[model samples]
Target: MKNYKISAIATTKIPPERIFAVLDDFGSWPTWMPSFERVKVDLPTNPVPHLNYQFRLRGSVVYADMQVIEYTALSRATSFRINVPPLTGVNRCSIRPLSQGRYRIDRIDTIDLPKVVVGVLDATQRARFSRLAQEFLTALLRTAEMRG
Candidate 1:
């Protein structure tokens, strides 16, 4: 198996608290994240630590159990995948306050997977993941701003 780190960062004119609100509401992910078909959370509201979730990815047969390992209000969150073949990760997301009510959003996934699975990802798959992450951040900002 090989270890891979995938990350995406986005800067927006949205407040960190607003961005964090979206992150805390795990059930709202499917409304914006294009890669997510459905997200079933153990809790309907805040992302409680140690809570498990079932994710259904769009256009993909892969299903995984994601457990919330850490969550800090308006700051950071980390999750781990369990019982998934050829894929597992400590996925972390963070929001930082910037100048003029702007905030920086970051998502990182440190994954361990078989070499063959990594090889199959090629440039296209990698680019797609990056794009999705970017879009996810943008949509999150929009959703948060709209709520204010």
Candidate 2:
């Protein structure tokens, strides 16, 4: 497996709680997330470790199963495991409080792609996922701003 990380950050003049509120609502992600097509939730609305959910991302019709392997509220961070083949790793989201009532939203993806597929789509996937990350951040920022 080839491991790689891509990150994106967006700063906003809103409280971290406001942003976290939006981020915590996993069921509502497809509505605002850039590449999310839909989510099939089998657990409660509130998130917890080990909870499973399936989501379909735009540009791909397959809905991958995912699990919340870590949810640390005190630090405002959560890590998800992609429980599917061909691709695996963690997608971590976090909120950082800043001065002046501003907050920084971060989405960091640690993707482990299969070696055979890595070299074939390495450059293309990196660029595509990077763009998607930025777009996701922009959408999250806008959604939080409007809510705040």
Candidate 3:
């Protein structure tokens, strides 16, 4: 098996709770998250460890499953195990206060790809994951800032 690790970081003036609020709302993901034609969650909101959600890829029949494996409300941190067929991902998003009215948001993803298919496409997928992580952070910040 081959592993690909990626981290996306950015600074924002929004509060941690505000940013986290957007994450808690799965229904709103389609507005910001790319490739998510539809999302389904067993719980209403406020994700905690063990909570699960699923999303259908846009223009595709594939359905991805994501399960929350860690969550810290006070720290505004959450981790998930994402399974989308041949590849499995462990993704974490966290927010830390940087200064007064400033904070940093990070999205770290580690994808375990099969060794057999870990050739040229591996690089492409890594790049894709990095883009998605960065995009997720940017969208989350935008959504949170717009809400308040």
Candidate 4:
């Protein structure tokens, strides 16, 4: 497996609680996340460790399962992919509180893809993926900052 990892960190004006609210709701991700089609959680309860979800991403035909491995309110969360061959992923997000209702958000996405598939992705695709990540982050920030 060829591993591809992307990490992003940004300081946002939104508070940690607001950002965590958006992160905890799996189904809401499609509204803000780039290329994210749908997500179905096994449990309706929010952000519990060991919670599992099925998700479709980037218009892919296959659905991936993810189980929450660790969760802490307004702080950190981590999840691992399940039952997906040649494309396992371990994704994590952490938020740190800053002064004046600001926060720092950090996200790490580690994907294990087949070597052939990675090889097929040209420079343009790589750049596009990077842009997608940035766009997703921007959307998350916007969602968290919006007034109720």
Candidate 5:
């Protein structure tokens, strides 16, 4: 299988804690993130600390379920993975405080798939996903700014 990685970084005026909190709240994703049509927790009534969530992507009718495997509240780092058919990727989101009132948001996604499919995706589909990531980060920063 071939591996695909896409990364993006953006600076925001918001603090790491606020950014991390917003990101950790999976249910609120659709509200702030325009790319998702819906995000629902299929588990128990109470919140699951390291839970898995199922989300339906907007525009396209694709559905993916990802597990929140890593979370570090102090460092403001969280990661999720989708290990199912059609999509197999890991997404890591982090925030680091910079000098002054600025903070940096970094996102990295690595996907694994067949080599032939990866080559095709690299030529055509990967760019779209990259753009989506950029837009998502931009919207996230804007949302955070507007809330303050």
Candidate 6:
């Protein structure tokens, strides 16, 4: 198996608190995120906090089920893979307070896949992942800015 780690950072003109608020609310993802077509937990009301959910990719229709492993208010959030064959990865989002009403948003994704498929997948999937990550962060930043 081969490990793939993708890390990205973005500077936003929004406060850390606002950014963290948006990041913590997983239910609101589909509202602002263009890449996620649907997001639903197992419950209707108040759902089971920290539960897992299956997400459908907007274009590719790829589905990935992820479980909420760690969620710290206004600081850090982490999730673990629960689906997607032969791939187990942890997704983490963090926010740091920066100078002058600015904040640093960081996403760290660690994926483990088979070595044989790496070359084939890398050429096609890497760009898609990168673009998705960038778009997700950018959307979050835009939402936070609008809320301010």
lDDT of 5 by residue, 24-142 (tens): 66667778886565544343355544534333323234445555655675333333334335657677878777888887888888887778876676545777888888988887777
TM-score of each: 0.75, 0.74, 0.75, 0.73, 0.77, 0.74
For model 6, the local distance difference test gives 0.67
Candidate 1 lDDT tens digits, 87-130: 67777778777888777788887888788888898898888878
For 46-131, candidate 4 gives per-residue lDDT tens digits of: 43433343333323345565666556765544545544443677777778789887778877778888888889988898887667
Q: In candidate 6, which residue ranges exceed 4 Å CA deviation? A: 43-65
Question: For residues 1-148, could you state the per-residue lDDT of candidate 6 as single tens digits?
Answer: 8888777789877777777677656667668976455654332365334434333222233345556666665445454454445367778777777888777788878888778877777656787888778888888889887877
Q: Across residues 7-67, which tens digit of lDDT does each residue of candidate 3 receive?
A: 9999998877787778767556777776554654444354433344433223244445555
What C-alpha RMSD separates each model from the true structure?
A: 3.6, 3.7, 3.7, 3.7, 3.5, 3.7
Model 4 quality (TM-score): 0.73
Q: Rate the local accuracy (lDDT) of all candidates.
A: 0.67, 0.66, 0.66, 0.67, 0.66, 0.67
Model 4 ranges off by over 4 Å: 37-60, 74-86, 98-101
Please write out the lDDT profile of model 2 over residues 1-148, one tens digit for every residue.
Answer: 7887889887777666666677766667778887565555444454433334333332234344555655555223334444344466777777777888777778888877777866787677789989988998788778887878
The TM-score leader among the candidates is: 5
Better of 5 and 6 by TM-score: 5
Candidate 4 residue-pair clash tally: 0
How many steric overlaps does candidate 5 have? 0
- Evaluated at residue 136, the lDDT of candidate 3 is 79
Please report the TM-score between candidate 5 and the true structure.
Answer: 0.77
Q: Which regions of candidate 2 deviate over 4 angstroms? A: 44-61, 74-85
